[model samples]
Target: DHQGKGTTEPGVMHQEPYGSLLPFGLHKGYALATMCEILGGALSGGRTTHDETLVSCHDAIFNCMTTIIVNPEAFDAPAMQQEAEAFLSWVKRSPQSGDAPIQIPGEWEENNRLEREREGIPLDTNSWEKICQAALQAGMPEEELAAFRALAQ
Candidate 1:
């Protein structure tokens, strides 16, 4: 059920009945994946992971996700806010698995944004290289790029 003997194949971790254990257990993850395949793959015109369509540049097959935004004005603000706060409080009150305190979904992202605002965003070497490449392609002077790097440090 695989390709020829010597061919480099996908990692065993990605195979069915095994990959289901990656983040969530089989039952929940399998259902979520099925729904995503239906909505993101079948609904979107874009290619699904199973699609054999090949592009020369990359080996990864991509799926498109559909996002719908909800307007806050359509719902009760104060009452909903109260319920959300209560739920978060209840979740946090659960016994901790480790010394680190529990954080709600948006908390880490909000903290990161605040930290980056106060102290400039930190980019890894590869990301900084990409930024330099972009600036260079846009005709930025090498001297200015060097200065920018210096300022970043």
Candidate 2:
């Protein structure tokens, strides 16, 4: 919402329309991103935007990721699962917005996965064309691409 031309303060100079990309929670979000960069880049011994990697290719992009996995059972909080269930139930009890029912974090994604599995995934014509082009470029035979394209329809 804050990216648009009129979103900024009156005196503030706006960038391109909807061009301002701020962190999610302003300062807190910025701090979180910085922490991730340090952990992912420095700790992982991978290059951040500041550090140069793959000196042979100027156009190469590098990605560094850090995943932290914690077991809830390791904690002494016995009521954690119950409390989480109660919170999820409370959130689901809220009124629906428009035609869609209220959903928790992963509910929508799970439902979408199920639906797409039952019924094939949907793709627009433009995207399908681009996918076919990519397949052709990746050395897929024209006859094979046509067969897959037929199945898509």
Candidate 3:
């Protein structure tokens, strides 16, 4: 049974329209998930969600990520580098309505990560209080918290 089926459980609840036409056509999503099962299960010789009672039970969750590491010197190195640079430059120069500049996939995340490390991560008061409470519950002394805060600086 799909988890989307209505239940009176206390935790988070999610329900979906069961008819032929679903919101955003969830049938499409189901079809895609079915395709993933075929690729990750049958093709890869792995177990899928349907094969187990618990959703987490699986031989291995196959990652479809494909990475190509090119030895530029083997090919036309300079030309390949020039072409990639030109393409990136064109993408960055493309018109946008937003105030900030357009960024490629990892660029924004890398920048944010660097900025947060340099300037300590800003947590809301409630979240900071919750963290302190958790630390206290875990038997973390005030001196230890102060030491951790000093390390952050």
The local distance difference test score of model 3 is 0.65
* CA RMSD of all predictions: 6.4, 6.6, 8.1
The whole-model lDDT of each prediction reads 0.70, 0.73, 0.65
lDDT over C-alpha atoms for residue 27 of model 1: 53
Error of 2 at 37 (Å): 9.5
The prediction achieving the highest lDDT against the true structure is 2
The order by descending lDDT is 2, 1, 3
lDDT of 3 by residue, 1-153 (tens): 134564454333222221122334555677876776677666665555443523453223455432447677887566887898899999999999979999988999999999998896888878877887899899999999888767644
User: TM-score, each model?
Assistant: 0.58, 0.56, 0.50
TM-score of 1: 0.58
Residue pairs of candidate 3 with colliding backbone atoms: none
Candidate 2 shows a clash count of 0
lDDT of 1 by residue, 1-153 (tens): 133233244453355322212326635687787677667766777655442543332333465877658886798685887887899999999998889779998899999999999998888999998999999999999999999989888
Writing each residue's lDDT as its tens digit, candidate 2 over 71-113 gives 9989999999999999999988887769878888889999999
Higher-ranked by lDDT: 1 or 3: 1
Better of 1 and 2 by TM-score: 1
Candidate 2 ranges with C-alpha deviation above 4 Å? 1-66
